[model samples]
Target chain A: MTEKKKTTIVLFSGDYDKAMAAYIIANGAAAYDHEVTIFHTFWGLNALRKDQQVPVKKGFLEKMFGKMMPRGADKMGISKMNFAGMGPKMIKHVINKHNAMTLPQLIDMAQELEVNLVACTMTMDLLGLQQEELLEKIEYAGVAAYLGEAEDGNVNLFI
Target chain B: MTEKKKTTIVLFSGDYDKAMAAYIIANGAAAYDHEVTIFHTFWGLNALRKDQQVPVKKGFLEKMFGKMMPRGADKMGISKMNFAGMGPKMIKHVINKHNAMTLPQLIDMAQELEVNLVACTMTMDLLGLQQEELLEKIEYAGVAAYLGEAEDGNVNLFI
Candidate 1:
């Protein structure tokens, strides 16, 4: 039998819109029967964080980073026209008006579709995020893992 | 002979650092004998704009967009820590100190390396940019061209 096509995405932006785009692509690829993986790195790790505060120990800088970042996908802001956090609201309103899914719903759909959601462990350490602070059932890996998957991928995207 | 690997990038961000990353990866892939193409779209088109102002007809919104966006790669801002344009200066200083190439130099190198630099025609129209306003020797295309290149690509990144 012919090998299945692979689609790997490196989600590097913390912006809500960017994450939504990444998930949308991942979900679409998965629906098309492509082996899809979304590797979350740097600011993108914030998307995997649990929406509620998770009590975790941290050093000064790590604590500061943890505190500064959005708790989860829902709290993340849009990439443009943020207008001090108003842009995300407007986007959500538009999504609702169109009867489309919000970012959280998109993530849920990705999960239901069995999209491989991976968090970059290096960035997680840098951001002071612990396993308990992230959603369950997600994988943790490094850049090497990403490169390994991407090198063989039919479509590899660094988003 | 084995087929040469392909790397295609959809540059969607206008930020200087993002553009630098895209070019760096493109140059690296080209050096490794990969057929690399960078599809500049949306704000990414600003990287291709000529530094000098070109007299082009435009509507009011287009004129405002042209005036607002950076004229070239050198004038683009960083993704973070911009500090009101200070961030780009600091990044330039650091690059010089390390004997690394600046964004403009990198673009020149990409041209010399024969990397395919394609501007998205659709975004150019929306942004009110014309052929005369962009650099010479680059191509203009749309999403179909990008998807055609990316489908067979080993690395297809959206930056």
Candidate 2:
């Protein structure tokens, strides 16, 4: 049997637009029959959070992170021209007008396409995110696990 | 002479962190003796802005863009955890503490290393950024020009 090509993406941004780009690329790579793994770290972890606040215990720093950062994809602002939060609303309007999938929808599609969504344990520990705060059916690991997958990957990217 | 492998980076975000990543990768590629071209567009155009605002005449929309967006690298915000602009300052502090090159320095190094920097003409026109408002050394092109470079490149990334 032919060995499948692998694509690994280190998603490190939590901006709605960047998250959308990551998912688009991940889904495209999967469609081409590549084994895809997206290592979501730092701000990228925000994408995994549920919209509603969950009752999860955390330390002082973690609690601060949970309160300050947006709940999930729905609350993410644009990377630039945020204009006090109006930019994202405009972008969402445009996306809907163009019949493009929302960031949340693309994420769900990525899961359905079997793109491995792995949260960074180190970031989680730092930010004080609990497993219960994120989506289900995802993997959690440290940077070493991501390195292992990326070691043999034909295409590796940090987005 | 043997042809060098080309790496094309589409820098679409103008946030300080994203711009830092894009420049770091470009510089890294140049260090590896790869031909690198960074196509800066939309928000990415802000990266090329002058630290001190130049007296370039712009139309109504262009003037609006200029007034709303950050002046240059030093003025950019973080992609997430901005905390109303404190996040970038914190990142800058960390960057300084580590003795890492600042974003402007990275751009300079990339230029010294002969990494091609191209501005998107369409975006510039849309954003009302005149060439005089940016650094003198750069190429200006549309999507087709970028596609031409990307078509033959071995590695292509969008940031």
Candidate 3:
């Protein structure tokens, strides 16, 4: 007999495409009748903002460092896959390409599918972001809270 | 003129769909002309294995624990995602659906497109997997080595 599967997705990528990927995967799991939870932290929190992501240019030193450094988030933050200028565009394309859902869709899907959504308080503090600044229906918690959820025998994923 | 992008991808999910997402994104980046790297570790290493993955069952105690648990990879080992039973099937579906490239195809694209593939040594140690056991193109490195790549800037990701 088929047993139930519980999966948790941790989003660390603040990048649009990566976040989209997480959202899509979570949505897929929900479609498959799996319990899903998403923990957003760090740059990942940027996706939770109710506005467009403002590109921040590094200062002279940072720019120089960035010049010598890697240029994309996947490489810098999660995995080193440069989305180039196409990161955001490709995200929209694939989502459209697959008729895949959006962040809001994923969020609503999370609720309808009973997926848990948790925002990292520590990350919020670091970013000077308030819980109220996030979209409605998000649960605010700390790393400890996330770890507690991760302790369950299901599956945990970092996106 | 658009500047060049250096990117890297860290893959921890061995599940087929998640791995396909990484590859899809990598292919997209390569199409856009960027340097890419993928560091696979833990369950992510399962993608590199020649044999199929063995399904894991939760014992009675594990089942009870699952009831109270968050259901994720942290409890399983390191940071990874449990892709449900559909993982392998979904991977095959998506790949076939897209006429998506094989791991070798993706690797070749990375090579032709200058994508670097690295395997995490720490995870290899914990999992008792050997370097020789992986695909020929894979390069093994310690976390520090990955950090070195990240420290130099470019892009770093943990997926």
Candidate 4:
């Protein structure tokens, strides 16, 4: 019998679509019956946080003022695009329309599917996010810890 | 009137989920009238290539072997974890399941969306892929080219 492949997805984009992609992929891996693990790092850490606030970016002039300010992921949120101001509402509509899960739904699916979810410690520190602020189910680890997981998998995705 | 936000997505992962995420985001961004660009580098380039081929590691042993193979995101195709026996089918399944388009479809979406699709020249050279081998619509540029775009945007995503 052929052996099952081990896969790990390292998510770095905190944006909605990117996070949704990670969630979908993790769900796909689980469907295939592979042991899947997701590691959230840097900006990717934002989505895993329990606070889940939107990110805010400075205006063009504000960006020009100096070093620029940190943009929170929650504020810049994924624009639903064609739905006009209805991107978020439409997203929820479409996901439900297609029976596809939402980001939060995907997150729930990850648990039901038993995918390992880990948040990067370094990013958490850089962002000043406390462990208590992230989803309680997520495991916190350093870069080395993530590398250890990567070392074991044949598939590693930086999303 | 508020100045429009121009966004660039730096795609580095070639996994099914990541690819799906980039596409969904691009499609969403286009719907919103945002100027969007996607720069494909490293493993991300694979999904864009005409000949899309990725090796699936079978088991623990194969994964260990994969890790020892190389650390860089060079020509060695991105690894798909535990693909087991169904490689081509799996790829198709993902594409169809998500109503996701192919590399060709993705390119078309970018064009229709006016999303600047760039192929990293350095990565192309490393992988022995000439400009001709890539989708006809893509622009080939170096890292500096992509950085220039990112420097100006209020939004940047590494997916």
Per lDDT, the best of the predicted structures is 1
lDDT of 2 by residue, A1-159 (tens): 999999989788888898889899999999999999998877898899999989977755567768888899888878778888699999999999999999999999999999999998755765678999998888999755765575457787887
Candidate 4: how close is chain B to the reference, as a TM-score?
A: 0.70
Error of 4 at A4 (Å): 4.4
Model 1 off-target regions past 4 Å?
A49-67, A78-102, A105-109, A119-152, A157-159, B24-33, B50-67, B78-114, B119-148, B154-159
**What tens-digit string does per-residue lDDT give for candidate 3 at A1-159?**
966665577988765545655665566566666667789888777656554333453356534442433232222232322235433443344445445465556556666877777889887666556555566687899888887776662545677
Off by over 4 Å in 4: A1-4, A51-76, A79-84, B1-159
In terms of docking quality, model 2 is incorrect
C-alpha DockQ of every model:
0.26, 0.08, 0.06, 0.05
Give one digit per residue, the lDDT tens place, for model 4 in A1-159.
976666788786655777888889889988998888888765576667554433344333322211121233332246236356666666667778898777877888898898988987654543345665567688888655554554446566767
Tell me the RMSD of model 1 versus the true structure.
5.8
| Candidate 4, B30-70: lDDT as tens digits | 66666778898877776565543335424665345334332
C-alpha lDDT score of every prediction, in listed order = 0.86, 0.84, 0.58, 0.62
Interface Cα RMSD for candidate 2? 5.9
- Docking category of candidate 1: acceptable
Model 2: CA > 4 A from native: A1-3, A15-42, A45-159
Best by TM-score: 2
Candidate 1, B42-63: lDDT as tens digits: 6788999999999988866577
TM-score of each: 0.63, 0.64, 0.43, 0.45
